[model samples]
Target: MKKIFAILMTVSITYFASSQSKTFPIASTLTTIDGETINSNTFKHDGPIIIDFWATYCKPCIIKYNTLKDKYAEWQKRTGVKIISISIDPASRVESAKKFVEAFEWPYEMYFDLDSELISKLNNGSKVVPLTLIYDKDFNLVHKSTGASVLYEGSAKKGVKHLYSGKKEITDFTVDLSKYFEIIDQIISK
Candidate 1:
């Protein structure tokens, strides 16, 4: 009985300890829009960090980026939160993505995962863009959200494939960015 209890306690402790420390692909290599290369582990900020995964072809991602750009200054001023934009655009679209970023003049640090290597590791082999990840000061992931879509019931059924086509208007889909902002607000308040 004593040995069984001891073993059970050890297993429980191990599980909790392992679960608390969420591991990311911190060593993954990424390239800046300027063509400079860096590792994911090099990201450093004074407070919380928001790692936003997006792509040039993702309309929902474009909307999210636009909204974030407008409020980025205020968010930084208030909470010291740093927004890191990770473009999950394929190698073929790298030039377009860089051009778009330069033309828009987004206020956040921009990086590219051309091979989807970083994003795949981060999202369990799912390379879906427009994904938002917020980490606390300690770099432990606290929140994650998949951005706007047309897949919701009663909404258009075009899905992400349509967004990639660039033929349909994105206004048909509902863009709700409130949840991400709310989560960021909560993390900063903490």
Candidate 2:
């Protein structure tokens, strides 16, 4: 009986700790494009936030950014969702990362993880580009996905053409962002 009670108590404690770990990491430090230092709390109150991790060298990251560039404005207007793009580049590439952002003129809030400290805290030091995390109004993590947006791609004969199934090359792909958008919509509606 004593052993069973002890095991149950241990399980309860572990469950509580894991559940509580979903909150945004207040200790995380990130640098703005202009070199201003900021922490996770800086945006905690502004929930329904999307934190997108990227690097200067990640092609999928650039593709993802370009794919969402135009929709960002509409998303903000519709859901009041705030997107924060953070560069996970090493310290040496910080300048290049800034230049890349400038050249693209990305409109969302931008920052850099010089030492990847924020990335480590939020992503368990995974350091993978194109990692996206969505936090709720209360700053609890609601969703997380790694890699670029899901792309629907297929191949077929040259003569195959249709309204919803047309193709120019052997393989055509389209970014699927509805999943993220739906999650954001749900988060705000809650």
Candidate 3:
């Protein structure tokens, strides 16, 4: 009987921990394109937030950013959503990353994670580029994708295409922002 009781207690505790939502590591230190230091927690938006982790040399990451940029304005105006593009480039490539951002004229909030501290915290130390985390207004991490994902319409069914471990070519792939907006809407409505 004692063993059974102990097992039950352990199960209960594990369930409780697993069921809890995780918040962003706002305390993590990150740098801006201008080399200014700031705590990540300072980023707050009126609604849901999207954080994309990318590097200057990551092709898939670049494709995702460009695709998202096409519909970013509409997404923001409709949902008040904020997208933060965080470059995980090393210190040596910081200048290049800045140049890339400038050359593209990306309007989203941009930051630099030189040491990947924020990425490690959010992705359990996985060094995968093009990872995206979606958070609700309360900063609870609601959805995370490790690779490129896009919604597609085929055969009368909508589908999601996912590529992982940087193995897929994203030259022709485009993420469906509508699906992301649907997810945001669900989270915000809850």
TM-score of 2: 0.72
Each prediction's number of clashing residue pairs: 0, 0, 0
Please, what are the lDDT tens digits per residue for candidate 1 over residues 23-108? 34377999998889988877766577889899987778876676567777987888788889999887789999988787777888
Residue-level error in angstroms, candidate 3, position 116: 0.8
Per-residue accuracy of model 3 over 1-190 as CA lDDT, tens digit each: 9999999999999999766644554678899888999888778765789998999887567766877777889878887888998999999999999887887678889999989999998888887988889989768888988765543322222223333344445544555555677888897677
lDDT of 1 at 76: 85
List, residue by residue over 61-136, the lDDT tens digit for candidate 2. Answer: 7656766777989888888888889998877899998887777678878888888888777778688878898888
Q: Rank the candidates by lDDT, best first.
A: 3, 1, 2
Off by over 4 Å in 1: 1-25, 149-174
Instruction: List ranges where model 2 is wrong by over 4 Å.
Output: 1-24, 150-174
Q: Which ten residues in a row have the lowest lDDT in candidate 3?
A: 151-160
Q: RMSD (Cα, Å) of candidate 1? A: 9.0
Query: Between which residue pairs do clashes occur in model 2?
Result: none
